[model samples]
Target: MKRFLSGTVPRFTLTFFCLWLASLKLIAQENARKVIRNIEIERHDVFTDLNRKPRFIYSWANQLHIVTRENVIRQELLFKSGDEYDAEILEESERKLRSLSYFGEVTVVVKTEGEAFVDVLVTTQDQWSTIVAYVFEGGGGRTTFGGGIEEFNFLGLGKRIFSEITHEVSEGTQIQLRYTDPQLFSSRWTARGNFITGPFLKDYSVRIIRPFYALDTKWAYGFTGFARDQTRRFFANSREFDRFREEKEEFQVFGARAFGSRFHKRRVQLGYRFSTKDITAVPDRMVVPLPDDEVSHALILTATFENLSFVEETQIDKFVRVEDLALGNITQVSLGRTGIPFPNGVKRFELRVIRSEAHQIFDRQYLFLTLGVQTLFEKNTIASFRLRYYNKFARRQTLGINIEFDYADSLEDSQLLLGGDSGLRGYPARAFTGDKRLLLNVEDRIFSSVNILTVQLGGVLFFDAGNVWSEETSINLNDLNYSAGFGLRLGYVKSPDSRVGRIDFGWALNGGGFGIVVGVDQIFSVN
Candidate 1:
């Protein structure tokens, strides 16, 4: 027995020692591959050089704009000195920086120093962060005019401050104040607050969150509260028929934990929500009954799956700007229940499922699809589907198509509307109201190489068709409305937001006459 024990112990000890040596060697190799030696950051102002025409004006503009702080850019990076060197991580860092509206250009370059060391260089160009201008939007004979001042990068930090005063046809004059800090207190947390007041409404909201800013983020949490008191107006054929006063308060808090790698991830979240709503009908103009008042307290659980894949393109949404499109799949499912007995002895339950998928159908064509379903058991249900397709068939040109459908069961006081403001550009706003809606939009977008005083230009020819039906009416293609239009686009290249302004003219085929639509940004989004 002693002889056998001695032989077995020696063999086992030698094997274990060899395995440990192998593990140590493997770890050393991994460290050699991942070690980063130094990082350099270069920040440029709105104008890197003043050698072009209007040099004096460009110089003055650059002097007026404050370049972003080095720390602000450094804080957003996912890797730093002594961290692992990963190409995907570097690309993700570039994307993160580019996503910020304040940065007009971002690039990350890496140089291998030795077998175990690499140097990274990050470069960024700033945009004009302060905007002071008049905002005007007119469509279907209705016009909303306003002016606002916004500073997207306040004091060289990634903060936003905005104040605006606007006059709308339905709600009269309104004043709004908003502030946001993407990196609150130089940390990952974000904070935002908004207050709006008008003759017919008062609203306020506050949100604080430490979100999953990266795919490998392990935990996240957030809190949001909102309150609003407003006069809700119902319109038909662009005419107000009924109005009510609604007061609502909502509060929600959630925490999530993520698991998996950067390429594929899963997140599980738990949340609690409390909300109350009350309605009062107008005394002399009560054409419709008021919605029922209710209070709810619920607990919710949600699971999410995200497959991370992206494609970078230019001239798709904004001219001369880089845009990243997610070409992966995302799915989420949520379940909620108000299981506790209330004063009214009523219980409620809710379920929501959302899925989105994107595909590269061809070399230059992409398609995106989204589906959503939500239900409050025994109360109401809503189902919506959207499809967006884009073909970059030629340089500086794209063909974009969008299709959307929505259906609601047991709709109460609310209405599903379609009109000039909602993709059916020929008719007035709220010209069609129903429980089901279908809309299709096609655009041949042509981005010009012309730049007039730093402003890029583009044009679009579009066709729109849509129909809406009440629950009592059956769906019919013959009842569809049609509109054709052409528009001009102006891309503000120097602005921090890179805003695109559009003006469109439409001719209605179904009795509605000519219409003009003016707005900011692209009319539709793929997501």
Candidate 2:
């Protein structure tokens, strides 16, 4: 035993031991398989039978198209008649089907057909994904109104098309169009295009992805081309810089592969970008120099591992709710390098790591945490962490708390500074910026269900406190800003529910003033 611990064992012995362990696991898996004698597909309506309930005739009238084809459902199945039953494969199939925006709920059940055979039943319920929407959104002393039409599952072929026109209060109007084909030309390749035009911004992009998901597939590939006018209003150490614009064109190509399991994946990407900047309107007080026209070429590599589990509960024709949410774990790591003998003469290396996890605790309570670390080779390192807690203290009530902290060592102007736009509800966009920041948010949510009309209404009261500071200044309690707000949540009833919209009104305690935010099911997440 001592010799083995000291690495005195022969290499062949170690290899044999590994092979033996793998064989044992394989044998166990083989023993678990039962013959699958039959496969069945069950597809439900896009909307619940709300007519059964009084005063829900509106739901019946709003019914759209049934966009998912039976063949589309069958193509995603991991098993077929005479195939062996594997629980992991079955769950994976369900997950893949649910990932489609058109699907509200996906369940795969296996039942014994005879002594040694089982039947596979795959059931799927559709979601109302065709949205012709009008938006009137305002927040943080700004207002934006827009209108859009989106078909998420066009003609049941899993295609998407969206077009919108918007007019901002102070900013000018904008028009946008987006289209996507998940299965291009009846193949596995996916294609996407986006276009946006406005007085201050013009952006267009096209992308294609050949994803690698099959057990026998070795690699995936993606390519993208984009041209955009990016505007940035920089604020550092609580001081603002005049708006800066960069007109840039970029092209990128990437390839990736899975290792050991589909949940673990890695990719390498190469890209070239050409940019010309104009900062003529930059304030004279700004200390940073404006960037000149230049070109850049770079390579980036990334790896990610994801494993999550969740359960979806549905009410017939009314709504689907995801309860017992558990994020097993997810981690991503990336490294990038720029200017390898490039024409633009740029040189930089960057690395980042992100990890997130969620689990239940003590029956009715849950905890979720996310951590991020980033570095620009040899110069600066930034780390961010967030911890969240959720408690279901009552049948229809929940309490949520989120705490976040961010720090930067030797910060640079080119780096992204922590700012209010992240989630300081009362503060205007970019109102605060600094090398370090801290935030705390607490929320109490109450849900009320209107089953007859297939509507779910929720109300939330929240408190937010946070501050950003520079390296030269220490964080002060007096410098912190506080915001108290109430928000309304509207969702449609169904198995696997959908958020219809949200409206928030907040009051600032530290002279930031009052703000109201309106959104259509848009939720913010810490990046």
TM-score of each: 0.92, 0.81
Supply candidate 2's per-residue lDDT for 411. 52
lDDT of 1: 0.88
Identify the candidate with maximal lDDT. Answer: 1
- Residue 15 Cα positional deviation in candidate 1, in Å, after optimal superposition: 32
Give the Cα error of residue 443 in candidate 2, in Å: 0.9
Off by over 4 Å in 2: 1-37, 48-63, 212-218, 235-241, 261-288, 305-319, 323-326, 341-344, 378-382, 408-422, 494-497, 522-527
Taking every candidate in turn, the Cα RMSD to the unseen true structure, in Å, is 6.5, 9.6
lDDT of 1 by residue, 1-527 (tens): 88986797889998999999999988887676757789899999998778998899899998888899999999999998988788888899999999999998899888546667889999999999999979798887678899999999998998999999999876589999999999999999999999999987899999999999987799999999999998887777778788899999999999999998887999999998888889998889788677788788888999999996988988777888788898889999999887543334236779999999998889989999999999986756889999999999999899999999999988655778888887888678788887899999999999998988778999999999998898899999999999998999999998875888999998898886988899988889653
* Quality of model 2 by C-alpha lDDT: 0.70
Clashing residue pairs for model 1: none
Off by over 4 Å in 1: 1-31, 340-346
Q: For model 1, what is the alpha-carbon lDDT of residue 168?
A: 83
